[model samples]
Target: MPVHRRPPLPGVQRLARALALTAAATGVIHLGVAPAAATPADPPDRADVKAQVDQLYDEAEQASEKYNAAQEQQKRLQREAGILLTQVAAGQDDLNRLRADLGAVVAAQYRAQGLDPTLRLMLDNDPASYLAGARSLGQATARQNETLRDLRERQRRLDQRRQETAAKLDELEQARHRLAAAKDEVRTRLARARQLLGDLTAAERDRLAYDDDARAARGADRFDLGNEPPASDRAAAALNAAVSKIGSSYVYGSTGPSTFDCSGLMYWAWRQAGVTLPRTSQGQASAGRRVSLAEARPGDLVIFFKDRHHVGMYAGGGVVVHAPHPGARVRYESVSAMPVNSVVRV
Candidate 1:
């Protein structure tokens, strides 16, 4: 009786993979390396340190976002690799089957008293010199053909395996690096925050705590998006796609194949092209290259109102696509109509 063996559970494997990937990215993103270009031991002021820490936190968030993106890319690639491996296996099976059939044909041809083509030529030649040369050549050709076939098959498999291995290793290593970097970013920010706490006088600390409590009452992350989106190839692609959707109809909160509201249009376009964007219009407005109306590209999001009260996809030809109001379909209207604010290029 044969013992049954079960393959690993895909769900379990996927979960494990997710954890491993997260761990690796954390490790790579958070190196315990020395600080960037040491300065004099003036030991920065508490407020200054606090500001620096805040900046570092911003950096950390950026790094975390990047790690998340890389993680997704790595996962996608792994699935692709598996598919490629399956194709490689099928190729090998087909090759072996074909070789077996060819062997049978060759054997049957020789067994029926019909000469092996290779041997026939040898027998037809002069007994000494000609026959000897014919025999040597025939045997050499036969051996060479077999060797060539074997080598070709092996090479093909080897090439495919090498490509797959290289891709996996590269993605795995990248994920590991990102993990480390992200962790380090968080750790550094926490350290700086702690240092700021230490520098505070008792009364100042109390005041700070009071301010924190006051801010807490407001109930918001208060996260400032102080910088532009990192320069990336995806930014351009995303921007370009959004630009093309100018004047498309909108349905409030609807992602689209054709129509979209302000945020819905962005979400749908980015998600469709495999680039993730935030779900809400306000979130989408802050997610990319922040710019002024003068700098806005066709694909960039043109935000409106002082507090960013509205948004629209900047479709060129002096038009933008957006849901006009609460109970309306998204449609394209003049950029001039709305109070144009900041622009965000993905």
Candidate 2:
């Protein structure tokens, strides 16, 4: 059966439709905003990442040089301490011998106590014989006094050597502490750099490598290393040795035929040339006669930064070959690539 009902108003129907549409739109907006809110922030660009990584590597290199300096100092102190120990032992033996000799002289005098020199002189039948015996007694007294003086001098010298050894040991301990701290700093910085690099996408890392290669290429193309002779035969040899290590990986504090740090590379190269440079960049800065950048020749050490924590061997014509930093290989770059601190002719 059909029942009669009042008809709904057009405005009421339209209002109901509008409310339904509004609810659907709200749901759609919420669904769209949820994913947008969950998305992560964009990663840093290659240039920014490279700059940060470079800075970290630079800091790590500085710490590595400090570590090297401390290690060298520790080795020197150990050697010096060893020598001092030997000297002290020898001096002690000499003192003991001298004391034994003095004890023997005292014992002989005690055994002969009953024979006083004055009494013997009075009792002797020949006055000349008594006078000769008195002269012999005087000579014995002089020898005992000389032995005492020698013993005292040796004891003083032994004390001095002991003090020197103690000082050296103290210095060595301090150097060890410094070495540990520097090593930790280098590791921390390097770890941070690695983490940053790891955060980068594979494509981003590849791009960075490409950029580095391109930059190196550009630097090489611009720098003209003419056939300028090295300052000396040794210099030429050192330069050749450094150049031969191109593509070898850089490792913090390494001074080797395979891996090297900035100063380590210089040290190793100079060693190959029959010269020994200092183990740290700061030390190497003063290792030889200082020269102007314009006077720089092949095998000359080019120091970088005011702190002088970085070093490279000059390859002439405003180019240098260096171990750069960790995660990098030995390569040639323009001398002006970093701030030039000084030039040293070794």
Top candidate when judged by lDDT against the true structure: 2
Top candidate (TM-score): 2
**Deviation (Å) of 100 in candidate 2:** 0.6
User: What is the alpha-carbon lDDT of model 1 when measured against the actual structure?
Assistant: 0.56
Residues 1-346 of candidate 1 have per-residue lDDT tens digits of 0001222322354456667766666676688543344234443244543344444433443333444445555676778767777776777776676667667656753564466655765676555765665567677568757865875877688677768767776877777677566556645655665666676677766765564344323311232222333234554555456656544543332467776545656676666557787755556677877877765555567776554545666655555545443212444456776566677877
For model 2, residues 90-135, the per-residue Cα lDDT tens digits are 9998888889989999998778657876787778899897687668
lDDT of 1 at 56: 44
Q: Per-residue lDDT for 255 in model 1? A: 63
Model 1 ranges off by over 4 Å = 1-46, 113-161, 198-342
How displaced is residue 317 in candidate 2, in Å? 2.7
* Model 1: worst 10 consecutive residues (lDDT sum): 1-10
